[model samples]
Target: MDCVKLPDVGSRSLTTALIQFGFVQSYPDYSLFTYCKHNVRLHMLIYVDDLIIGGNDTAAIVKFKSISIGASIYLGPLKYFLGIEVAHGPEGIFLSQRKYALDIISKCGFLGAKPTSVPIEQNHHLALAKGTLMENPNRYRRLVGRLIYLTITRPELCYCIHILAQFMQSPRQEHWDAALRVVRYMKGYPGQGLLFCSDSDLRLYAYCDSDWASFPLTRRSLIGYFVLLGQTPVSWKTKKQHTMSRSSTKAEYRSMVTTSCELKWMKKLLLSFGVAHDEPARLYCDNQVALHIVVNLVFHERTKHIEVNCHFVRDELQRGNIVTCHVRTTEQLADILTKALGKEKFAYFLGKLGIRNLHTPI
Candidate 1:
């Protein structure tokens, strides 16, 4: 077994060998490699020296394991990878970072703190908070950074983490307190995680929303979108828009464009896995004006001020890549990602996102 210390050279060498072995790398996510032939299919997810091998054919997996690649140890079925703990059952695969979450609580001295129903207060103006600057910004940054990784299995933490992450350079006391509040919330359900069901139809659908001018400091809109593969959530994001929006319609339109790009990439990635998405992806938005803009040309005249490039949602509609639909505000799942919500609403949205905690009663 040979070890390459340089990350760049090691990654390049590994990629070259995998390509030579007839495995096609995924362009959307470079860490993924797939091998498909006839009725057999194989997938390998690589992260540095660790590799997860799986697929339909058991024989193909054994064949790949026999390949001469220095010395490798098969870890059997994935129960734990990196910090993520996986539990497989009749329902599906359950993924969580319980140990990691507990470690954060222990480190922050929040193990005994009372758990809050919500991570953040509703209508929080975190961006405009003013207080004493942290004497040790390193602690604040480290906590926020770890929370960011914990979001892999805890989607409910995305919005609060996104807000806290902005003050990394010079976090104030208020920001630090907010970060600790999140830790307290984690104490309530440290074992909560995402569940990928076994019996899914493999269809693609998405919900997108925007909170117009939500950030008081920059007056920029907050955009959030969630993508699902049948019953499982494959991708989601909450980001502050770069450009200022004059109207809520424009903000929602920009969010749809962002989600359309994610849908296209997800489609290609699924194809690599031998799953073909033949139908137009369903996109749900609560804004009527944005839905109208997707199907009407007259709205274009009013939105001409929005950069031409930002109108790609319309192009995707025309190309039949995605079908837009209207969803009531109460039913929008992405709403939690865009703003802070009350306990009942937050818990309601969390349940819809396929999040479950095995340690808690059903």
Candidate 2:
């Protein structure tokens, strides 16, 4: 009956029982588990009782299902799980939360509102925007929370949500208004989501970008990176850096370090899933100076002030674990994450990231 002690107890008990059955975690994270037994390979992702199992051998999966869980339903191919709807075809699988998005819009009472072309305005900046406090902060908090979860399938919402989340403690009218704008933007195309194309070759490629000292209040740069498995985007993060960077190149190199960590973990994860990418992952950057600092030995006096941790990306390059390639600033898909873009630029980057509308024919 105690809530605090229950989760830890349940996790330990579940991990112990699963490990006994030959299922081992990729890391200490009990949520992810894999079991390879007698050519019957199985990968199970467990979040409490919700289990998503996948593998090459269906016989092994069916055998495990019969042995455990007692009751089972085979959906053949994964069409829906959690809140994401999957559309699988010859091209690949498309994941969408269109209905979930619509539900958010309807619940927020923005169903009749005019949809915006961009989530946030191109020149709009929300920094300590002063306005009267909302009568009910709880409603704003709850709405922002729902929008935050939507970033899983909707990357465009990342920056907007990140900005709005800062005001949860005391949401003002301006904050509420900004949050509503994001909801209205979502109304434009509720079916927009990521597309995993089968045509993409099995290679690891990542793009990293930063908006240096863009935050008006903190002056800390925003770091953003997205990793692509072949052409399918799997992981992404848009976060403001913790500390200030003396130079733009330092900010970018810092972003590269953050992205490299993700690439390393993804490689290990793919290996467990039977995807072995022996080649070094390609990392694209729009800043030529950052790439120069990474590949060249001479660290300028200006960049020497950068923390030692940021140089790990340089080490990764030297060791052949990654290759830094130059990409045009206009073609930098990660640009959307670092700053707000207009309709034309936003649409271009959205297409580049392989996120498209999985619109159902009306």
Candidate 3:
């Protein structure tokens, strides 16, 4: 099969066939196809040549596997897909990148290094460090790229990975060492992964927070969000704002807007799975000023300096898509994604995010 030609032609043909078979393409995610007939529903997610099919109807799933596409093979139950290791048990579905993470650790030659409790040191300023750039920066770029992929099952590494990724264009020794420290931390818990609890509710909620002007060089704030379907983390991100935020409220408000958009997307994605998310998703923010800006209509002057699109939060708020709520600082779970934390606090939030090691002995 020709690499370039196969993907375009094969995917287009498969997509056309799936559509003709009464499968509706997901609006938010085109690669996903959903089939809903009365109470029976099926969802197929396309990843290049791979197809992951799931549904509650056993007969429908069997019928899907026997499609006319003779080239498609049924891989029975899913134990491993891509780099992620999936395990099923009474606790629910456990997703991990144990092998992928270990490979990265070995690649960095940190297999014998001492493990740290936290991924990064608290208040550590990585951007201000000035030094000679590495001669061969591709190694650092490749390693950081791998670390970014590992975040799929390890959301706790999002902030540190985000910081390290910034230096990809011109990596220095300090940045390299910081990246190694993250690798060492991952060595401590190679098996740690997110667990989807069997008894978890279907309710969706999210936490959004920002570190105002966290980047000293650009004066850009760091925004991080974690969205959970019940207690299972479905989506999370740690990104630096494109533009500088003058006030902490604006930084936090921008964070809320990003999270609101993700929640709306999640709602639509759930619809593809036949899950009706009619209730407003709960949006938690520790900043009172930001929460006020979201709920109060008279706060226009304060947020006038903010980007026009940032007001999408307000539209979603009034449309009954999401409800902004004030959460105390101590209870903010998304804090881990915005900045580093102490060993104890970091561990506390990790447990709340449903990160665990299924390989550990009870």
Q: By descending lDDT, how would the candidates be arranged?
A: 1, 3, 2
Q: Which candidate order results from sorting by TM-score in descending order?
A: 1, 3, 2
Clashes of each: 0, 0, 0
What's the TM-score of each model vs. the native? 0.95, 0.92, 0.94
Residue 108 in candidate 1 has what lDDT?
Answer: 91
In candidate 1, residue 95 scores what lDDT? 91
Every model: Cα RMSD to truth? 3.0, 4.1, 3.3
**Best of the two (1, 2) by lDDT:** 1
Using TM-score as the yardstick, the better of models 2 and 3 is 3
In candidate 2, list every pair of residues with a backbone clash: none
Clashing pairs in 3: none
**What is candidate 1's TM-score against the reference?**
0.95
Better-scoring candidate (lDDT), 2 or 3: 3
lDDT of 1 at 317: 88
Cα error of candidate 2 at position 196, Å: 1.2
List clashing residue pairs in candidate 1.
none
Q: Determine the backbone clash count of candidate 1.
A: 0
Q: Model 2 residue 338 lDDT?
A: 84
Q: How does model 2 score by TM-score?
A: 0.92
Worst 10 residues of 2 by lDDT: 1-10
Model 1 residue 221 distance off true place after TM-score fit, in angstroms: 0.3
List model 1 lDDT by residue over 1-362, tens digit each.
Answer: 01111223377788888788878899878999998878877788888877787888888887777775665666677778879998888998889999999999999988888899899999776788878999999999999999999999888899999999999999999999999999999998899998889887799999999999998888899999999988878899999999999999999999999999999999999888878888999999999988988888774467779888887988988999899999999999999999999999999998888888887611
